[model samples]
Target: MRVFTVAEAKAMIPEVRERADVIIRLRANLAELSLTLNTTGESPAGGGVAEMKALEAHLGEAIGWFNGHGIEVKGIAPLLIDFPAVLDGEDVRLCWLEGDERLAWYHRTELGFAGRRRLA
Candidate 1:
């Protein structure tokens, strides 16, 4: 539940990108696993239900970490993460933005879209 300033959150772009990469790979692997399950009606030797649970845990940890850093955990499919980080000084919204690229035009907690500013 740690709050962050715009600058602090933006500074995390690098780490975020890395985490994003991992998420993408994990998701792809999960899809493959799903297909295997569908075809075989069972997981491979090591790819048991436990592996799926582990992936879920990993995804949850990643999302939770991002949330803690002030970014809203939007849908994992489209990968939409919202920021600006506050809603009346109390983190209110999570995964509630309209578009992915809208981050540039969207507003922070205190400022509406009319007041949206570049992430400097």
Candidate 2:
């Protein structure tokens, strides 16, 4: 696994945030399209198979970008990302959640998000 320094991780925040926003928008569109298709088999507000396919395609592209950048995309609902990093001589994951505006948290590898701690 690639380990990033804290500075390196923070420097990536802006780009990561932008990509995450794009994914969030795509996810919202997909959800809406799915709801409409499942219940009534068609969307009244411009959603359809083509639109869904486009959104999914963009989503896949975004995910691939993240993978290429070495950022771990953790969840979809509340989009989560973690950067493999070592801090204070210990292994940690720099965590970023959907609503976070900055890279200010981290967690030990074994603890998952339940162990998230603020960066100092």
- Output the lDDT of residue 13, model 2: 94
Tens-digit per-residue lDDT, 1-120, candidate 1: 556555565566667777877777777778887788778878775667778878878877877877776677657775656664554465423222322322333454554434544532
Please give the distance, in angstroms, between residue 13's alpha carbon in candidate 2 and its true position after superposition.
0.5
RMSD of each: 5.2, 1.6
Candidate 2 regions exceeding 4 Å error are 45-47
Worst-scoring 10-residue span by lDDT in model 2: 43-52
Cα deviation of 58 in candidate 2 (Å)? Answer: 1.4
Q: List the candidate 1 regions with Cα displacement exceeding 4 Å.
A: 1-5, 85-120
How many residue pairs collide in each prediction? Answer: 0, 0
Error of 1 at 110 (Å): 12
